[model samples]
Each structure stands twice: as C-alpha cells, then as structure tokens.
Target: MKPGRYIIPKGTYRLTDKLYLTKNTKIIMDKGARLLRDHNAGFFINGRTGDSFTGYDGNGNITIEGGTLDGNLTARYKHYNAIGLARGQNIVIRDVEIIDVRGAHAMDINGCKDVLIEGCKFKGYDINYTVDGDGASYMREAIQIANHTEAGFNSFGSFDAQVCENVTVRDCYFGASANNPAYPAGVGNHGAVADLYMKNIRIYDNIFDGMTYAGVRPYKFENTLIRNNTFINCDYGIRYSNPNGNGTYDAGKAQSGRNTVIQGNNFIRSKIRDIYIVGWVKDGITARVKNIQILDNIFEGVSNAETMYLSFCEDVLIRGNISNITSRFVMGYYSINVSVKDNLVNGITNEVVYVSDATADGSTSYVGLGYTKDYYISGNRVENCGRSAFNMSGLDGVEVHSNVIVNASTETVGTRSAIVATASTRNGHNNKVRGGLWIKSRTFLNEFTVDDYLRKEVKLIVAKYTK
Candidate 1:
C-alpha cells in the first residue's frame, strides 16, 4: 500500500484494478478522462485479484478526489456498485462525475461512518431492466445505505446485518432534467442490512430533479435528517416510502424509522405526494408511534400531490410550511398527538385538511379510520379549497382552533359548514372546534356543522367551546 498520486492519463480507460488504488492512495483521474466499466471498477482494490472497487471500507483516511466514472451501461455486468464503502471511516469523495451506471447503486454506504460525498454528479442508466449479476439488483439510487445478511449476499454466509452511520450527501447534483432530463434518484435505503438499521445519515443542501422516484427515500433508519435541499419537477419531492424502498430487498425485513426530520426544503411542481410519511408497522403495540417532523418547506405547482399525506403516525408536527396550487394540506389518518399549524395553504379542488378515516359511508376506499385521535389544527390560513377548510370524522379528543379560512366552499358543498366533523359510525367521540373563523366574516362562523354522514351515526361530536 503506497501513499502517492496515480494520475489517470486523458484517454478512454477500461475500469479495473491495475489502474491504481491502495491505502493512503490518491488516484487522480485527469480531467477529460473517461472510463468504461466492463466489470466492477472499485474506488479501492479488494486486496489480491479483486476486480471491482470496494471504495475503501474497513479502512481509514482515504480520499478519491476527481474523475468521470462512466459505466458503459449500454451493456450488462454483475457484482458492481458505482462506489462501495464498507467498514470504512473518514472517507471523502468529492468532485467526481458518475454517469450511466447500470445494475447497481452509484454509491453503497455499508457499516461505515464519517463519510462525505460532496460536489458529485450522479446519473443512472435510462433503462428499466436489472442488467446483470448474482442477484436482482438494478441501476437504482445515486446512493444506497442498507443492511443485508451474509446469506442474502451469497449462498452460505455467516454474519449479522451491517450498519451504516453518519454518512452525508452534500452539494451534489441528482438527475435534474433541466440539465439532463433523465437523471436518477438522489439516494435510497435498500433495506435493513444484515437485519440491522442505519444510523445518523444526513442529506443537506443538494439540488435534485429528474428523479423518477425521490430526492431521498429512506427505510429502517434512525435519527435521519434531510434539510435545505431544492427539488424541481419530479414525481415525488420526498417519497418517504412506506413499503420497502425499491422492493428488491431480500435482506430479512425492512424496519420502520424513528426520529426522522424533513425541514427547510423547497419542492416545485412535484407530481405526487410531496412529503409522504407512511409510518411502517413495527412489532409489539399497534399504537400510533409518530416520531417524524416536517417544517418550514415551500411547495408549488403541487398538481396531484396530497402535499402532506401522513398515516399511522403519532406525535408528528407539520408547521410553518407554505404551499401554492397544493391539493390537500394534510390527510392525517390513524394518527395521534399530531399538530398542523401556522401554515399558508392554497388549493383548488380538495379540502385543505381532512382528518378522516371514518366517514358517513364506511371509510372511503382511500381513507380508513382506525382509532384516529388526539390532533390539533390551528392558526393556518387557507383559501381557494373546494371542500371545507377542515373536515374531520371518526375521531376522539381532536381540536381545531383559530384557523382562518376564505373561499373554501364549493357548489358540491352546498349548505355545508367551513369546518365539519362527524363521529365515525363505529367510534363514539369528543372532537372540538374553538375560535375557528371565516376570514370573510371576521368572526367565528357557526359554520361548524355536525352531521351523521356515516349510515345513521348519532353526531359529529358531543361538544364545542364557545367564546
């Protein structure tokens, strides 16, 4: 292992181990350099006769400074990751341009910590097929952090799941179509590796677009933070996937996340579900265990997005966010101890907030209430919503306070109040509205209408607070 600079000449180089890599090695690919991957071109050689690049895991103080890693994606191969890091620490990869990678992730963060992937450009192959290899892998995410059992990787294996910790993706460019139109995703959680969860991953200050999926989609993660990013014209701003991220995980099971935060981001013209938080079902108590927060974000041209489609969560918070042309502000279902407050929302076709899992009919095919309760919606300024400003049903101990609504009634909503709540046909309830105001009327509009929408249910609630 040498500590020296191996300069890649400016030419079309085939990716292999002979090019140069070792402990304390700084292999600099000359600008205008292009590489073709007939096989796995690793960031670091995997010892003797290692054909692929492992990208320095279980090692330390390694840096891969610059290069254009062009995986000749037109063809197919096996056993390759655009970059793989396992058991490595203090690794830095910056100013690298990776293009047309097929059959695997652009980067793999496995059982590593203190890694930084910055100033990088990642674009995945345009095809939809899982090219080659020993498994059902594809050219999927720009970065992947997952845990897989040894048995999952090979036939006869011996090991638990690996854990990735403290990895950061900053100032990178993800397949934004305004530039390349078909860029790939930013990052994804393949699933629990070796039956273990990832810990402490950070995604910050990146520009993402053209992501067929999302800027960042995670699973089985802990204390994850995604902040200060800009997303433009993508299918999903932040998918927050409920099922397995890519659905190809053979690694045991995918666990639910904890203490996740999505803050200070901007999403524009996203086609669906801007901030979708579908919490997974964990073992033990089926209680609402919402430990997520979404704050201070801007969303525009929300088209078909639910804006914030949260479900099966508790103790969640959505505050200080602004939206334009957004469909629904919040569709909180099976949620408890939640709060949606102090936001400005404008939409054209739906209710600004609908906390319903229990409707007059059974729950709609789209929403089913299962003990939905303990929510607070307050101080939000909503307008142009076709349905009522707020609609709640099948609830207990919910509060709607001081929300200012304007232009919220539709022709289809004739004689309906601005804020409506009905007890689910199944659950008896205590839901309240206090200081709720119609902005045009300047006072609390007894627009509070109680109803028996669910097949002859008794009432919307048992009481209300009068000023």
Candidate 2:
C-alpha cells in the first residue's frame, strides 16, 4: 500500500504494467493519501477483461474508494490517461479525487457495464492546455464513457466497434476554468463515439460549474437519461458536436442515439445555447437525437445565447419547460416530426421558436432548410418577445396553434408578427399558425396571420400559405 503523501517520483514508469483489479477486489486509500505523478503515465489502473477488442469476459465486483490521483501538471508529462477500464462489470469508484489530470480522461469507462462514479471531485486537466508537444488536447471530458480503447481519444471511422452499458455518474463536482489563459476548458462529459451503440447511461444530480465547453456533450448513444443536474455558467449546456467526425451523414457513417430523456435540469447563466442541438456538419442527416423527450426543465436568466436550439432532429418532443431572457430559440435544418408544446417562454429578445433549414456549415447540398418538415408547435405561452412569436422558415406541414404570443420589444417596428414566413427560400409553403393571442400581427404571402380579434380576452393569430 502506497502510504499517505506518497510521491511517484520523477522517472520513466511506463515499464510498469497496469494494476489488474478484478473480482471482489477493494483498494481503499486513507485520508490525505495521494499519488503525485511526476511524468504523464499511461494509466493508473488497467482493467482489460478480454484478450481482444471484439469481446469481454466481464471483470466484475471492483471498488476503488478515496484517494487523490494528482497529475502534476508542472512536470514534463508522459502519456495521456488516468484510469482505463476495459470491459468491466459492477465497478464502483466513490469518494476519489482525480485532479490536475493534464492529459486525458479521469475515468475511461470503455466497454464497461454498471459503473458508478459518485461523491468525487475533478479539476485542472488539459483545460490549462499543457500537452506533450503534440497539440492534441486529449483530456476533453472529465469522465468520458466511450467505446475507445485504453489509448488516447480516437473517434470512429468505418472499423470502430464497441459499447458501454448501465453507467451512472451522480453527485460529483466538475469544474474547469471559464477563462483559462492557455487552453479553453474542456467539455464536462463528452461522447465522440461512432458506429458503436451505448445503453442505459444515466447522469443525474451532478454539479457542472464554470466550464468553458459544454456541460454534457452527447454525440451518439441510446437510452440515456440526464436529469436533475445543475449547470452553472458553462459555455454550452447539453450540446452536441460533429455527428460522426466525418463530413457526410449516413447511418453507417454516424448516428446519434435513439430514446434519450433530458428533463428536470437547471441552467443558470450559461454563456451559449442552454439547450443545444447539433446535427451533421455539412451533409444533411438525421438529428443527433431521436425519440427524445425534453420535459420539465428550467432555464433562468440565460444571457446572450439561444435558450433552446434544435437542428436535424426527428420524433422529438420539447414540452412543459420554462425559459426566460433567451436570445433566439431557433430550430434550423432538416428537423422532422418535432413537437414544442405547453412551454412558457418569456422575455425572448429574438425568435421565440423559429424554424429554418440552415445547416451549420451552410453547405447543405442534400441538407438544407427545404428539407425541414412536419413540426407541430402548439399550446405554448410566449410573452415579451423581440421577434415574431413564430418565425416559420422550416418547410412543409408546420402547424403553430393555441398559443399566447406577446410581442413587446423596445424597438417595435419589425417586431410584432405572429409568424414571419419570409420569401427567402421555397420554404414558404404549407405552414399554418392559428388560434394564438398575439397583441399585434403582420402579413406575408405564404406567411399568413390569423388574429381573431373576435375573442375578447385573446387575439388569435394564424398564418397559412403564401403566394
């Protein structure tokens, strides 16, 4: 047992093999115990249960509790990693502090199941941008669960294949600098996986505060639940990045997970988009998330970013949430079969929930605003919005009804419209906005408006079809 305040002195330690911790093994470090790495070592512990990458014998019943693995960032570092788990089962890492990790992940739960990381603290890794001269910032996520190997961070091409299942990260403190002088802080939790599928990952009740990157960046997975978390002033909250790390969007190329539930989370002063959505970069693919239910969330005083953002998505439901001080809650490009209902949006300085077919890169040969279709925005309450209550640029079968939209902006000239179906693209057809109380209204050809002044208490505004 390495006693308290032990120093892993300055030397070449790659000659040491990893600590193979398996069945019913418990390694408990006492208080104030520490492992200070003088060089950037490969991994602190390795749990490779299988001989090959294609299978796993399932290493089980491992518990590592309470110690500080401190990657002395000031040292001439070594390889990039902390703890790499290969195909493990029932691993519980509790009350351990992984700090100054400087290179790669704190816990690389690769091909694992039933892993729990709770009551720990993580900070000051590659976020400060001191690498091994390769310019590769490997320590992107504080705790990343991926299908990659014990090696550094690698994305999927055509040949990558693995899966992680039943992982839970709860009651942890994750903080990176909001403004690191050398490097921008990395994402709190990241998934840059492709081809492979993950299942039953639940991240709840954690505090992600003051990160420059995203709070939870889910690239692709399945059956994931992120609930009851608190995000304070992160760059982006619950966002996504490049779909498959490639340009094109094919199911075989890359795909987001189906069956995700993001609900009951709180966001305070997030810098960028609070509820972010990322699709394929250049090519038009499906949404990064499908069959998603985002419900009962609260966004307070979100500054300078869109409160909610959606891009290429289908079969999604955003309901029963409240957001205020929003910039623009816009959904652009190739969003299909979405429903935004029964939500309260207040003090929206930009579009409450606008729809466009504009991709991120704007090089959508097959993926453009013309392809965004079949969204139902109904039963929502909007108040004090600068732009239109509904800006309908998303094409085909768009229905906006039964909503209260109050356009109260300081500059009221180009503001008070129930819907703005512009003549920009051919996306101005077959859309309808009806039965909403708009304090004012506007008129476009395909962007029609229905203001039912006959209703004494409410003004119903509906716009359908343009010439």
Candidate 3:
C-alpha cells in the first residue's frame, strides 16, 4: 500500500507488510523509534531528514532510498537481518546514509541470498573525549552476514553453519574518526570497518578510510573477489581467513572460498601490515591454501612495521607490485610452494625477504620441510636499501637470478652485505649482479657481469661476466 505524504513521527512503530512513502514526503523515525515485521515488502523513507526506522523480526526485503536513517537499529535480539533479505531473497539498499547508532551494527543478513548494497554511506558516531583507560567506542560496523541457529540468534554460532551466499558490496564509503578511543596502541591488532563471512562474494570499487581495523575481512568462504578498492589510513587493508575447520580453504570449498583473488588495489599510509593470510590448523595437520593470487597492486608510504605476512599456506603467488618506503616487503614462516617475483622495492630499510625454517622457538624441531624449489626471483629492481638487499637464510632449491640491485649504501659504513647466503645447503647460481660496488666475499661459484650501457645489449653480454 502507498502512504502518500505522511510523516512517521518520533517514538512510533510503523508495522506493515509493504509500505511505500511517496516522492518528496518525509517519514521520521525519531529518537527512540522502532518498526517491526516488515515482511516481503519495500519502504521508501524518501528524501527526509531526522527519520529513524528500526525493524524487528523483519523478513523478505526493505529499501531506504535517498534519505537518512538517523537513529539506532537493533538486530541483535531479532532473528533476521536489520536490512536486506532477512531469511528472504533478492534485497537491495541503495543511496542511503545511516549514522549515530552507538555500539550497534548497521546491517545484518541471516541465511539471506542475492543481496546487493550499493551507493550507501555507513559511519560511526564521532567521539571527542576518552575516559583514559577506556579507549574509544562507537557504532561497530556497517554490515554483517551470517546464518541462523537455535542457540539464541545473533550470537554467530559456528563458522561452518553460517552459510551466506552471493553477496555484493560496491561503491560504498566507510569512515570513522581517528580520535576514537578504541584505536590500537601498536600495529597488527586493529579492527576493520566491515567484516564479511560468506560465499560467492564480489566487493569492488569502494573507499575505506580512517578505520581502526581491517577494511575488509573475508572468513571461511570461496570464489571471492576483492578488487579496485582504495584503503587509506587504516590498519589492515584486507585479511582472508578460514574460520571453519576445513583442511582446505580455497576457491573450491562447498561454498567456494578456495580460489580467492585480490588484484589492482591501492593501500596507502596503513598503520599496520597491509595484507594478512592466516590458516587455522587442526589435528596437527596444516590446511592447504591454493590458487590465492595477489597481483598488479600499489602499496605506497606503508608503515615500516610489516607489509605482507604469510603463514602455513601452499600454492600462493605474489607478483607485479610496487612498494615504496617500507621497512620489510615479505616475511614468511613455515610457508611452502610460494613464488614472489616481478616486484619493485624502492627505498626499503630492512631485508627485502626473510625466510626461515625456525618458528618462534628456535629449535631443530622441523614442523615440516622448508622447501623453496622451482622458485624464481627475476626482473625485479632494488635501490638504496639500508640493509642487505637480499638475505636468504636456510632455504632449499632456491634461485635469485636476473635481478638488478643499485646504490645499496648507508652513511655509517656501507658494509652491508648485498646478498648474504647464510648456511645455504642448496645451489645458488647464474645470478648476474648489475652495476658497480659489490660487498661480501666474491668467492662463491656464480657468474657476475658489469656492463656498459653505451655498448648496447649485444657486446656487453660477452664483455662483463666471461672475463
């Protein structure tokens, strides 16, 4: 039914199956107002201000178009999503701005299907003063997706049981103030602006800034694609994990989280690490991570703490990226079947790559073989590094060939090793070190070339390394 030119006053509950607000009319769900059981319908709080609408046990679909939902919405106690397809199908929330909900989630989708959230702005309330020890607190997140259970809904029971499918979030903006008290004191433990747990998801072309946590967190699902997003002044740009107890979490799971792709994004001024891939081990056996590709991205002015941290995975590829002004590029522990190539690191302070068989506890305890075979590090460039440009410790069957290293020196002595191979039991060969000024003993069995650029590419190949 159409309610033409009506205003939902403050502190009132507008309950209906399908209620439509006419164009240019106002429906205000003022401070402390609620709406319940809007089943299989649509509501247009069209072009209004100071209108608040809350849904309880609401199902099917609801649309808040071109207006402001300026109050709190509570789906924590209800059994359905606060917005979009709550135990229903095909919901859409477009062109709305929601704000000033203290410690409340913006939207929740439970067992919903084919949901789309576009052109929306979700933000937390601003906080000015902090109570010293009690950091800052505001509205939690913009959107959440999970499944239903009997153990008193909204608790998010098991990672496996919460099955959300075919979700899309595009062209959205998520922002929180930096002065919020809940901001982390150090790196590696910040909160995200949005958390997503679903299958067959596509998140693209969004802008996320001033968030205390990760920009996007995808947990326990597959065939997910995160591309063309901008993350600024946040802690972690994106984090992918498998919270379920499955031995394999790729784009091939029952929900298809097995083959995930993160490509063509920008991460700038991140307070902590930019990207993280965490695998939860069960029964003393590590999970297999396959077909995870990170390609064609730019990481500029990233924090010096850590950039890319990978743990317990196989068949991972990191290629065609550019990093500037970073402390470390990649740190791997207990990783297998990995390839890092065709990347540029300019003005790096620490080692470009640190690989070890050692876990946190330095023992001869080999959890598994530290194998880096059939690996290639080619067509990369490093300039003005503070420490060793390349440090490989305790690696097997590795190759560091056809790379250019230039101007690796500091003020304090320039004694840094250009390429330090510590206790390497494998063959290190065919490495052409370009440019002048070489450090470390040149007693290793490898070919070295010092070519003149004016001689072109033909005569220089026969002149430098052969002599």
TM-score per candidate: 0.79, 0.80, 0.69
> Deviation in angstroms for 210 in model 2?
1.6
lDDT of 3 by residue, 279-317 (tens): 644555555455678888888755365667766556678
Off by over 4 Å in 2: 1-20, 47-54, 75-79, 127-139, 150-160, 176-194, 245-252, 281-288, 359-370, 413-415, 423-455, 459-467
How would you encode candidate 1's per-residue C-alpha lDDT over 211-323 as one tens digit per residue?
A: 77677787667788899998887777776654432344433333456788889999888877677766544433342334888899998865457787776677888899998
Question: lDDT per residue, candidate 2, 1-467, as tens digits?
Answer: 22122233333333233455545666776767776666545434534333443344445577788777666566645545677666667888898777666556677667778889898877655543442534535326777777644333332111243567888889887875332211123323344454666678888998888666677766576778889998888777787543555523234455666777989999888898787765654344444557878899998755468777776677889899999887865555567788889999887777777776654466545434356777777888776677677776536666666676654342474445555554443433333445443423222443544544523334322121111
The reply for model 1, stretches above 4 Å from the true place, is 1-3, 9-11, 16-21, 40-57, 75-79, 130-139, 151-158, 176-184, 193-195, 242-254, 282-284, 287-289, 358-370, 411-415, 425-467
Which one wins by TM-score: 2 or 3?
2
For every candidate structure, what is the RMSD over all alpha carbons to the true structure, in angstroms? 7.5, 6.5, 9.0
Q: Which stretch of 10 consecutive residues in model 3 shows the poorest summed lDDT? A: 184-193
What local distance difference test score does each model get? 0.63, 0.63, 0.54
Q: Where is model 2 poorest over a 10-residue stretch in terms of lDDT?
A: 458-467
